[model samples]
Target: MAKKDKSEKKKKSAKLKDAEREARLEISGDLGTAITQASRSLRTVQTRLLTRSGLYSGQEGVVLLLAAEEGLTPGLLAQRLGVKAPTMTRTIGRMEAQGFVERRGSDADGRQTKVYLTETGRATVDRISSANKALERQATQGLSGKEIKVLMKLLAVVEDNLHAQMPAELPEPIDESEDLAAE
Candidate 1:
C-alpha cells in the first residue's frame, strides 16, 4: 500500500509541473499581445500629431533627416531610415507632390538623384520637432525619469532577444505603389 501511495504522489507532482509550464506560456503570449497593442496605440497618436504638421507617419523622419542635412540620395535616406529603396522613392515622390521636397540629379553622378527640402519642408520639420516633444511628454506623463529609463532598458532587452532569433536576411519589402494607385 505504501508503494502505491508513493506512485500516486509522483503522478500529482508531474501534473503540477505541466500546469505550471502551461501557465507560463499563456503569460508570455499575453505579454506579447499587450506589447503589440501598445505599439499600435502609440503609432495612432503619432499619426494624428504629424497630420497637424502637414506630414504623414513616415514622412516626418525624412523631413527631420533632410532638415539636419540637405541633398541626401534616396538610397542613403532609405538606408538611414532602414527601409527599402522603392519605399523611399514613393515617399519622396509624395513629398515632391506636396511641394515639401525637390529631387535633382547629382552633378557628380548622373544616375543618382539627391533630395532637397523646400522652404515649406524646412518649416514643417520645425513643427514636427515641436510635435514630437509634445508627444513624448504626453506618453510619459506620470512616469519619473528613472522609471522611463528602466522602461527603455527593458524594451531594448526584449528587442535584442527577438533580433537574436531573426534570420540573417529578411525577405525584400514589397513596393506598395501599385496598391496606392488601385486605391
Candidate 2:
C-alpha cells in the first residue's frame, strides 16, 4: 500500500514539474509560481503554529472575525471569508465541536445561523494572534518600511483581482477520500 502511494506521489510530482516548466517558459517569472510557492511556505508555518496550539490555518481567522463581531451569520462569515456557505458550514462544524464557537439561530432569520466565539476560543485565538505576529516579524525582519507597505499593497491587488475575476464564492474543494482516510 505504501509503495503504491509513493508511486502515485511520484507520478503527480512529475506531472506538476512538466506543467511548471511549461508555465515558466510561457511567462517569465511566472506570477502563479511565485504566488503558489509563497502561499505554501506561509501556510506551512501558519499550519504548524495553529496545529501545535490546536487550531487550523483558516479557522483562527474565523475565530478572530467572530470575536470582533459577535453575531455574524454563517452566510455573513462566508461572505467575509470569500468562502461558500457549505465550506463555512463544514469549518464551523469543526470549530463548534471543538468548543471554539457556538452556533445559534439568527434572531432576524430563523433559517440563518449565527456564529459566535466562545471564551475558550478567545484565549486560543489570542495566543494564535500573538504567534502570527511573531511569525510576521520574523519573516519581515530585514524589509524596510516602504518595502513592507509595497508588499502589502501588492498582495491586496492580488486578492482583489481574484475576487473580481470570480463573483461566486465557491467552496474550496477538498479531496474527501484523503480527508476521511486521515481520520
Residue 45 Cα positional deviation in candidate 1, in Å, after optimal superposition: 0.8
Candidate number achieving the greatest lDDT relative to the actual structure: 1
Worst 10 residues of 1 by lDDT: 21-30
Per-residue lDDT value at 182 in model 1: 89
Compose the digit string of candidate 1's lDDT tens values, residues 119-146: 9999897788788888889888758999
Top candidate (TM-score): 1
Q: How good is model 1 by TM-score?
A: 0.71
* Model 2 C-alpha lDDT per residue in residues 106-127, reported as the tens digit of each score: 8888997788888878888678
Off by over 4 Å in 2: 1-29, 166-183
Give TM per candidate.
0.71, 0.70
Where is model 1 more than 4 Å wrong at Cα?
1-29, 165-183
Candidate 1: clashing pairs of residues: none
> How does residue 105 of candidate 1 score in lDDT?
93
